[model samples]
Each structure stands twice: as C-alpha cells, then as structure tokens.
Target: MDPLYTTTDDPNDSMENISSNFTDSYNNQFVQPVWQVVVWAIAYCSIVIVSVVGNIVVIWIILAHKRMRTVTNYFLVNLAFAEASMAAFNTVINFVYSVHNEWYFGLGYCRFHNFFPIAAVFASIYSMTAIALDRYMAIIHPLQQRLSSAETKLVIGVIWVLALLLAFPQYFYSTTAELPGRIVCYIDWPEYKIWDFKLTYQICVTVLIYILPLVIMGVAYLVVGLSLWASEIPGDCTDRYREQLTAKRKVVKMMIVVVCTFALCWLPYHVYFLLHMFHPDLLEERFIQQVYLAIMWLAMSSTMYNPMIYCLLNDRFRAGFKQAFYWCPFVPEGSYKSLELKTTRYLQTQISMYRVSRMDTTVSTVLPFGTPDDTTEPAREEEPGCLRHTAVDLSPNGSTRDTHSKTTPPPSPTTTWTSED
Candidate 1:
C-alpha cells in the first residue's frame, strides 16, 4: 500500500495481493506510447552525450594547460568533474528508470543512483558558490590574499567530503522492493511519530543543493555587479588598468550567465519534487509521467550548458576549444598555437619594458637630485665607479620625455604575461 506504487486493476487489491497474481511479466501501467518513449529517449540521450563530452573537454582544458590552471579554473575543473560524472553515470539510467517505472539495476545501483546525484549536485553548486566567493574577494577587496593553488585544491577536497556526508543518508535508506509485477527502487525512510522524515529530508536537500547556494551567490554577484558598473574609472587610470577592469567585468558577467542558467534549469525540478512530496496525489495524475520526464530533462540539461557558456563568453576558453578541435577542417592553421604560446623575444621585450617603467618610477622618487629639467645634453652611460644616469624632460604638453640612455643594459628578462579568466 505504499504511495509510490499505483493500484492494480482491482481497486480493492493491495500491492501484496496484486504481487501474488503475477510471477513473470510485470504490467507497467505507466508505460508511454512507442513514439513518446522514442522522443523522450532522444532528448535524454542528447543531454548525456553533450554533457559528458562538453564537461570532459572543459576539464581537459583546465588541467592540461599550465596557463589555464588558476584558482577559478581549478574550481571549474571540479565543477566539470561533477557534471561529467553525473551525466555519464546517472542521466541515462535515470531516464530508463523513470520512463519504465521499474528498477532493473538492482539494489546497489539503486542506492548509487539516488546517492551520487545528490553528491554531484552538491559538489556542482558549491563549486559555483566557492567561485562566487573567490570572485567577491578578488573584486570587492582587491588587496586581500586570494586562495593559492594548494588552498584551492584543499577547498575542493573539503567540498567533496561535505557532499558525500550530505548524500550518505540517501544511500543508506535506498532499497529495492518486489512490488505487484515489478521490482522498484526507492528510498524507504523510517517513519517518526512527530514528523515526516522523508519530507523533512527532501526539504533539507532542496535547500542545501539549491536555495542556500543560490542565495549566497546572488548576494555576492549583486555587490560585485554594482561595484563594477556603478563606479567611475579614475581619470589617471592607465590603459592596462582599464583593460584589467574590463576583463574582471567580463568574468563576472560570464559567471552570472552560468549561474542564471543553472538556477533556471533546476528551479522547476526542485519545485516538482517538493510538490510531489507534499501532494502525493499529484503523482497519480495521468500526465504526471510526462511532467516528470520534462522536468528531469531540463535539470540534467544544466550539465551541458556551462561549457557552451564558457566558450561563448570567455576568449581563453574559446581559444582552448579551438585548440582542442584544431584538427577540424575549418580551423585556421597555427591559430591554436598562438593562443597560449608566445615567442621568447616577445616575452623578453615585454619584461624589459615593464622593468624599465618600474625603474623610471623608482629613480624619479628616490634620487637625491630633484626632478630633471629640460636639457639637450646627452646623458653618459655607466662608467666604472659611477652610478647610472638618465636624462628626463618635461614637455609643454605635460608629457615626460626620456632620453634613450641606460647605464647598463637591462638584464635578459625571463617573465611572460599571462591572461587570467
């Protein structure tokens, strides 16, 4: 007489009574038509294919390229790992079970099917939450020390540990039962006199996996958006500073799109499950099977959208994707190579320029002599027993002119510029 199972043709017969009437062939009353099943199968299969491939590629892009291994990308790796794992392990299985209303995979898989999705979802959203906090720290408090690579890895580990703990109850309570004509897998929560344990657990899972993280990210992004958009650029800000600000804004925008996509995809799923818990009669409606399929498909579709979003909104990710698929017929030759690789001479020149600029600031600030006056005198290069000298002139237009004079050639510079996410 469990609410999960529908009554047999005989309205008065209980599940126990119905089970005795069938031995071999199960009457699947919820079965859809052949065409509807085929369409649903195609939809679900597409989610699996795109999600697994897209997320795996995202993981590879982050982990394979040393240049791509930042704190944000590390969190992205975790997010991709969770999404790919869920899509590969759970999506199609969930489709088959939901559509057929039978559990063919036995008790162990049933437990895993229920348990791992929760854990994966937990890891996925909280990875996003971690990214939001990281972004907030970076933009709102630029001087604060950001998470190092080691610290980021440790945080990812802690996220998984917490996810497993949160999902453990689902695994423990999951069991398979031989109902009227079919074996079914479900969570068998023990009843309590004071409250409905199942409903309470569902509510907790919904909050932890969906509501709470969304709230945190919402607040973080709201502040970040205001700061980035509402503030005016300083009059003296350099082009490099302006470029950096634009880059930060792009990153925040990309993440907001990703977060919104995730929220929209999962909102209906949480609503559906919550309603099912409270109004069990809704499950008995004739159209409910199709409703469940549509909702589940939308939720699972979230797994595939992030890689697409990154490709669209991020230049580096787009370049990485191009690099990954460079073998394609349409990709221009040598395009991918330039995305991450720079010439040694180009890097050296950039480093030298950066050093010379820094040296100019230092020499102007700490020298014993006052600021240099306009003069056509050529400064002499370094001689043994004398300090380096350079000539600087202030033009009428307020630009400082520097003579091409150096006491010593800048040492061969080794640093290279790296683009961040």
Candidate 2:
C-alpha cells in the first residue's frame, strides 16, 4: 500500500497514526478535494485583511483626531488594538494548524500560539465593559464628571496587566511535544487530576471573559437606553439641543450593536470548548475537526464586524474612517467637515465683589455659572439678591466680551476652542 493512502482499521493503529502521521494522515483524509482548501484559504485571508485594516483605521482615528479623543473612544482604541493583534498573530496560525494538523513553527511560537488569543480576547471584552461603564456614567449621571484622558489611560493600563495575568496559565502549561517525526502543541497538565484542573480553568475563563462582562454590559446598555429614551430635553427646542440628542442616540446605538455582535460571535466558540472539556470522547468523532474549525473562524470573525458596524452606524466614526482612507472613491469629498464631532468649549472666569447685607454691610460675592457663546442674552431679573453674568464669546483671535453685561464685570476668561483645526 502507498504510504499516503494507508488506512488503519485497529484503534491502536489509528492512535499511533495520529501521533506519528498526524500531518500526512489528517491532510489526506480531511482536506480531500483541493478546492475546499482554496476556498477556506480565501475566506480566512479576507477575515485577516478586513480585521487588520478596519481595526487599524479605528486606532488611527482615535489617535490622530483631537476631537475623537474621548474616554469612550479611548476604550475603543484598546479594543481595536487587541483585535488587530489577534488577527495578525492567531488567525493564520490557526488556519495552518487546521489544514496541516501539526505544529511546524517550533516551541517558542507554540507557547505564544496558546497564550496570545486568550489574552487578546480578555483585553477586548474588558475594554467593552469599560466602555459600557463609561457610557452609563455619562448618561445616567450627566452632572458627574467623565473620565479624563489620564484616568482612561490608567484604566487601559490596568486592563492589559490583568489580561496578561489571566493568560499566564496557558503559557505555563502549554508545550510542544514530539510525536514521532512531528510536533503537536497542547497543554501538558500534571499526571494528577488534570481533568479537574482543566475544567476549573476553563470555567473561570468563561465566566470572566464572557459571562461577567456580558452581564455588566447588558445592564449598563439597558439602563442607559431607558434613561436616554425616557428623559426629556430641557429648555426651548434649538438646533444645538437637537444635534446633541441625535449624537447621544447614535452613540448608544453603535455601542449596542458592538456588544451584541461580540456576544453572538463568541458564544458558539465558548460553548464548544466547554462541551469538549466535559466530554473527551467527542474529540474522537469524525466531524469534530470541522466543528472546531467552524467555531474558531466564527470567533475570529468577530473582530472584523465591529469596524463595519461603526462605519455604518456612526456618522463621526464613518467620517473618520473615510478620512483615514480618503483615496477610496466611495468617500465623497468635503463631507467629513460636517461629520466631525462638535467641540466642547470650557472657560473659567473669576469674580471679586462685595455684597450688601440688610444693614448695608459689605459681603464677599461668589457666583458662578457657565454660558455658551450663543446664549448671552440680557439677564431677566427674577427676584431680590439675583445676579446675572454675561457669556463670553470665543473667536478666531481671542476671547472678547459681548459688551452685554449691565452689572459689574468680572475678569475675562481666555477661550481654548479655536476656530481653526
């Protein structure tokens, strides 16, 4: 019999064949018909290309554009980085292993091969959780201050550290064992209670990576959605208020799509691993290899869809993506200007004055309020002891008073939101 076409009827021979001729036997048996390999190769390559380009564009938008640098966007940047890394490092390696049925990259990459995907996934899911919490804070308590850039940086730093710690177990346990002429990458648990250890580890990973984050994000988005939908806009109906409301709703929608897509894409992969852990016999099934490949590709495909979702659902992100890939003819010229997020202006004005008591005794005055450039109308007298302040106008050159104040004036505040980019 030809070595390539040899068949083992005995279970012992089959086991020996798997150990010794894993690459040759499995390739000859499974990847029959060259067209199947070509199709799968094309599909996996597309996933990698789309994932890398889309995630890199997101990172570029957040980093290059000053206005896009918000706390939520910062968390998104972290997520994009994780996805890009996973696609670049894990996807092709997985495809090769699936087709070849052996580890050929030697031992060093085998450790990383086991380690990186888990860590990247941990970081990605936690980043979503952080974004959910950020949105909850922003919407639920509008008066409360949002996380500053520095604070967000610190949080992202902690997330990566935690991800590394969580994935360290894989690196510790994984090894490439020589099986006849080939090497197979697998976890080498100790002789005692290896099943128990694997079960516990997998359970812990599933909970932290999937269940906990899912719960937090679900509750957060639900509350945020209800709050935004139920709450009423204050004051008269102005274009600015309309824009703000529209932007807020769009952001909520984008985030909901992101979280839901992530959950759906990863659900099958996690469930399969959990089932495999409990039933080792399933691994011997003829179709088990196909099932594993399908679930894994589904999981990795998750990274590619978020960028598409963002581009489709969000005007700001879409515009940013277009700007990054301006050469793409689909992007219309001069549209990004209007799509840029509205800049928020901040100014501080200090006042020093004396107030009169009932007996006309002087008292220190401490009145503070923020007014935008457009709302600096004459103050309507409401009651006694009421003081009205003038709104400062921000301009191209410098901040100038509107000259509409009737009372004693305070020190002029310099505006930082310049007209030019």
Candidate 3:
C-alpha cells in the first residue's frame, strides 16, 4: 500500500531531496491562512481568559468567606477548579493543533494533553451531579440528615478518583505518530479491535459523562420543582419561612438553568465526536471542520458561564462575587446589608417560633406572629441567597426548643462574595 502522506517515490532519492520535500509538505499541511489564524487566535484567547479569570474569582471568593462554604458551594468550587485547570492546559494546545495539524508538544505531553481534559470534564460533570443531588436532598427531605462537611469531602474525593480512572484510556492510547511528514497527536487503538474499542469507549463516555448526569439532574430537579411548587406551607408559616423557601427555590431555579446550559453547550460537541467516529470521511470536509470548531467552542465556553449565572440569580453568590471584585466601584458595602438583615430575621423567626410553640405547648395550634399577607417594613431589595437553620427539639412538657442553637452571628464584613467547591 502507498504511504498515506509520503512525498517520496524512490528509495534512491537523496537525503537532501527527502528533507526538502518533507519540509514543503509539512508547511503546506500545517500553515493556516494569516486571516484564519488571527480569527482562531482571538476566539481561543477570549475563551481562555473568560474561563480562567471567572472560575478563579469564584474559587477565591468561596475560599475567602466562610459564609460561602455551603454544601452546594463546595461542589461549585470543584467545578471551578476543573474549569480553570482545563482552560489553562488545553486551550492553547487545542488552538494550535486545530490550526496547524501538528503535534509540537511531543509524546509525554500528548498523553497528558488528552488525559487531563477528559479527567477535568468528568470531574466537572460529576460535580454538577453532586450539586443536583445535594439540592434534591435539601429540598425534598429538609428534615433528613444533611451531608456533613466530612461526607462532602468524601464524595468529592470519590469523584476525582472516578474521573482519573475513566480518563486512563487517554493516557494509554494517546501518542505522537508520524503521518506523512508531520507528527500528529492522536489515540491509536490496536489494529485487531480498533473499531470495537473505540465504539465501546465512546459509548461509555457519552453515557457516563453526558447522558447519565443529565438524566439524573433532570429527574432530581423535576422532583424538587414539584415538591416546591405543589407542597403547602404550614398554616402558621411566617414570612421568614416563606422567604427561606423562596431562597431555596431560587437556588433550584439557578441550578436548573445551569444544567440546561451545560446540556445545550455539550450536545453539539458530543454529536460531532460521534459522527467523526462513525464517518471518518466527514473529517476531511471544511464545512465539517468549521462545525466541529464551533461546537468545541461552545463546549469550552460552558466553563465561563456558571459564575455569571450564580451572580445573577443567587443573591449570596452575587454578593460573594461583588466582594471578590470589591476594587470595582460598582460593588458597595450597602449591597450586602439587606441580605444580612434578611438572614438575621430568618434566624430570629425560627427561634421565635420555637419559643412561642413551647409556651403554648401546642405545635399545631400556635399562630404566627404576623399575618402572612402583610408586608413588613420596606427594606433593601433582595433575592434568593443563603440560609442557616438549626435543628428543633420537642420536649415532653409540650415545649419546643432548638437542639443546638445560638445567637445569630453578626453580618459578614462585606457582601457579593462567591465561592466554589
């Protein structure tokens, strides 16, 4: 069989002729038009800048403020880490490979180039899954045990471990192979079972990375939405209780948008990958190349939007982000005051409810301090943020008290701080 891309015809050709021909071929294959290179450079740089900066800000905000360290935020932190790592390591490499069609980074990095992104992607998707589950448990079974910090750590550890295991195939099969005159970094399967191996791996990744998480997130959120929209508040429910519920629901809504966005961004990329796998001829078409680039861009851009979603939808995260960007004149100290007041009111209301029910010795008959229909004093504008709740204990004397409660702490020093898992 003729060599796929070789330029030489005779073994008797001089070494100088072979070298010259190879250089010409390599340049022809690898060099992009100047205009195309500029366009791709801009696109890749923008994505890398947004993803790395946005996710780093998220991670920093979460770390700086203890108030931001909720179970859900922890997962977000994990996601930010994955996104930042992926953007840092893969963005330029992908751009060069797509534009140049050569592997300049050599064999060692070839394995890592493929493996790290896969691992990071797996970690990111599963982190989102973990958040969905946490939210489901919080909303669907509020009274049941919440995941403690230690348990959350365990789950995160498991996610990374699984991601590493799943990405081992890239490490095993990715290498730099000479094609014609250029070295290309690609996954090469054994000849005997190449198609079978590829098909199995592709199916597994599609199912595990995209399909499974999306399905579980959809189901979990569906249940959570039903429970929130359909369930009735207690007869004596206070504004604080309603506010807390509203806050929780806002979180659910934000997460729903996040999951939807993730699915939309990744769908085309996965489709393209599967198509290329099944129809290798399509890879040679310029239109298909453009489509693939667009899809990959969308997928890469997914990492840039979560922090924005959190900032726009969740008051607490918004506040955290504001704090993170405090140098900007837009985020003032007063922005957080309203959220603090609301949080303080919530804590006080829970305590008041416990005390009033205790005095009356009747949990069912106790009336709320204020009418639910009546609005209290006007306060700063607010939306769904964060909350802290203590367990309630009922005594034999027909009194209710908090199992482990204390005076509400002072407000955080600033607002608009956000964090990640």
Best by TM-score: 1
Model 1 lDDT vs. the true structure?
0.70
Best by lDDT: 1
lDDT, candidates in the order shown: 0.70, 0.67, 0.65
- Work out the TM-score per prediction: 0.78, 0.77, 0.75
Model 1 alpha-carbon miss at residue 254, Å: 0.7
Candidate 1 Cα outliers beyond 4 Å, as residue runs: 1-27, 330-334, 341-421
- When 2 and 3 are scored with TM-score, the better candidate is 2
lDDT by residue (tens digit), candidate 3, 131-201: 88877765566545667667888999999999999999868876555656567666664444335766678
Model 2 clashing residue pairs (backbone): none
lDDT of 2: 0.67
- For model 2 the local lDDT of residue 150 reads 88
Task: Give the higher-lDDT candidate: 2 or 3.
Answer: 2
Residue 357 shift from truth in candidate 3, angstroms? 15
Model 2, position 220: C-alpha lDDT score = 96
